[model samples]
Target: MKQKDTGVMLLFVTTLTVIIWLWAAGQTKTEATVTTTVRFKAPEGMTSTVTPSFASVTLTLAGPRSAVNTAKAACANGLDLTVAETDGTVSINDIASRLNALDELKTSGATTVSAEPSAFNVDIQTMVQVEAAVEAVLSNVTVSGDVTVNPATVTLSIPKRIRATLPDAITVQAVVSDSALQQLSPGVVHTRDAAIRLPIPLDVPDVTVSPSRVEVTFKIQSMKEETVIPQVRIILAGPPEDYASYTVELPRKTISNVTVEGDIDIIDGIKSGEYAVFAVIRLASRDMEQLISSKPVTSFLAIGKDGAGHQLDVSVENPDALNVELNIAPVSGAE
Candidate 1:
C-alpha cells in the first residue's frame, strides 16, 4: 500500500510540473518579422492602379509567442484593404493601423511595431462603359474592298479618368489570324472571327471590351503579275540651265528584257503599251559641274510614266542593271 501511494504522488507531481511549464511557454513574449502581401481592392464601379499590383510588405510584430506565430501566419496569407476614396494616396502608417485593427491581428494579441515600405500611392477612378467602333486588321494579303466588321462596335468598360483624356471616338482592332490568311484567295469573299484589341495608349488593364471577338469579312485581290516590257526608252533630263549648257549621251538608248511585277491589270496595261515605262537620267546643276571635268559619271535611272499619267505601282526586277553611265560634255562655245 505504501509503495502504491508513493507511485501515485510521483505521478501527480510530474503532471503538475508539466502543466506549469506549458502555461509559462504559452505566456512567453516573442517577436517576429514576416514578409506578406498587401492587396488593395477598389469599391464597386471603380478601378485602382498601383505601381506593382503585387506589393509585398514586411511587418515587425511583438506579443506572446503563440500570438506572434498566429499573427505572422495570418499576415503571410495576405492583408486585403478596401480603398474607399476615388483618388489620392494612402500612407503606410494609415495602412498599418488599419491592419492592426483587423480581426486576425486583434484576436491573436500581436502588436505591429513597424511596416516597411514607408509609403505607397493609389490611383482610384470611377469606371464607365462606352461604345467603341471596331475595325478589321489583316496582313500578308491584298484586300480589295473595305474590310467590314459584323458588330461594328463593342461596349468598352474603361476608367472615367482615362476616358476624359481620350478623344470623343474610340476605335478597336479585330486582328485576323495567320492561319486564316494562308487559306484566303483572290476573287472570293472571306469571313472569319477575330479577337478585338484596343489601340495603343488606351490598351490598359482598366479598359475592357464586352465582346471579345468580332466577325470580319473581306475580299482578296490578285496581287502579283509578272510581265516583260519589250523596250523602255532612256531619256536624259535636267534643269533648263544645265540642259542648255551640257549635252548628255548614253551608250544604250533603250533597254530590253525589262521585267516588272505588279497587279494583273497594271501589268496588262504595261504589256499592251497603254502605259509607258521610261528610264530617265535626271541631271542637276551639280551633274553639269561634274561633267565639265569630262569624266563619265554613273547615275541611277529612275523609272517614270509617260504623258498618259497613271499611277505606276510596279517593282522592276534587277534594278541594278538600270543604273547607267552618262557621258556629258559642254555644248560648243556656250559658257
Candidate 2:
C-alpha cells in the first residue's frame, strides 16, 4: 500500500514540475524588433558619389538592461556612415552587416530583428570641389580666373592643430597691381591678403597642411627713410645760344641709410657740399629702370630738418644720375 501511495505522489510532483516549466518559458520575453539610425557627412569637392540619403537601419536590439546601454557603444566605432548627395537607393544588406556586427545587442539564445530607419534622416549639402596648388607671389597673389570650381568659393577653416612649414618671408619685388595693391605712392601700406575673404580648401584628398593659407602682412616704411639721403645738384654751363634753360632726367636718386657711420669730418663736410653733394636730381624724361639705377649726382646739400639745411654729418647716398637743364622763358614785355 505504501508503494502505491509513493507512485501516486511521484506522479503528482511530476505534473507540478511540468506546469512550472511551462510557466517560466511563457514569462521569458522573445527577441524584440527595434529601430534606430545613424548620420554622417560627405567630403567637399566631390562632384558626385553613389550613396543613399536614408537607410532603413533595422537593429536587432536585445539586452537585460545591461545590453540596452550597449547600443551607445554599438555605433561608437563599429557602424560607419556613408553619405551621398541624393536619396538614392538602400537595401537590407546595406546595413544588415553593421547591425548584425553589433554582437553586444544580440540575445544569448533568441534572435532579434532591427526595424526600418533604426533612427532619423541624415542631412547632406553640395560640397565645393577644389584642387589646391600653392603659388608664391611677391607683388600680390591673385585668385585669377584661371582657377575654376563649381561653387566658385569654399569655406577655408584652418585647423587649430594643423602644422606646416610656414615661409619665413614672402618677397614682393616692387610690383604694380590694379586689382588691390596699387598704392605705390612711396608711402607704406600694410598689405592684407584678399585671400582672407576667400576660403582655404581643407580635407584635401592626399594633401596634409597646417594653416594652409596664411595672411601675408607687411608694414611699408615711408617711400623714403627718415634718415638724411644724398641729394644731387644739376649744374649747366649753357643751353643752345637761343635757349635759356634745358630740362633733363636723373632717374635714380640718392638714398641713405638711417644708420650712418663714417669719419666726423667727411660726414660733417657732406652737408656743406664739400664731398660733391647732390641734392636736386632731375628726372626730366620718362624711364623706369633708368630711374632706378644708382649713379653720380651733382647738387648742393639743400636738405634741412625744416628744408633750411640742418647742421649734421651727411654723406652721398645713391649718387647716381642728376637732372639739370636750361629753358628759354619769354620776357614779360616781349614775346
Top-lDDT candidate index: 1
Cα TM-score of candidate 1: 0.60
lDDT of 1: 0.73
TM-scores, one per candidate:
0.60, 0.28
Q: Candidate 1's residue-wise lDDT over 1-335, tens digit each?
A: 99999999999999999999987897799888999998877755555454344578888899888889899888878987666655555543555676788888889889988788745676556677889999788764568878899899999987777788889998989999878776767879989989998988778877779898999999988644567766667776668877778778777776676665555566677767566666555667997878732222223222326554333333345555566666788899887
Model 1 CA deviation exceeding 4 Å by range: 88-94, 139-153, 167-169, 177-183, 193-197, 200-215, 219-335
lDDT of each: 0.73, 0.38
Q: How good is model 2 by TM-score?
A: 0.28
Q: Write the per-residue lDDT of candidate 2 for residues 1-335, one digit (tens) a residue.
A: 99999999999999999998876665554444444444343445443332344343555645343344455355444344545445334333345444454454443322334545444444333322233333333342223223222222233322222213323222211222345444543234344443312223333332233233434344433222123543333432222432222233433323444223233444455546554433443333322213333323333443433445422333443322232222323334432
Q: Please name the candidate that would achieve the greatest TM-score relative to the true structure.
A: 1
Counted clashes in each candidate structure: 0, 35
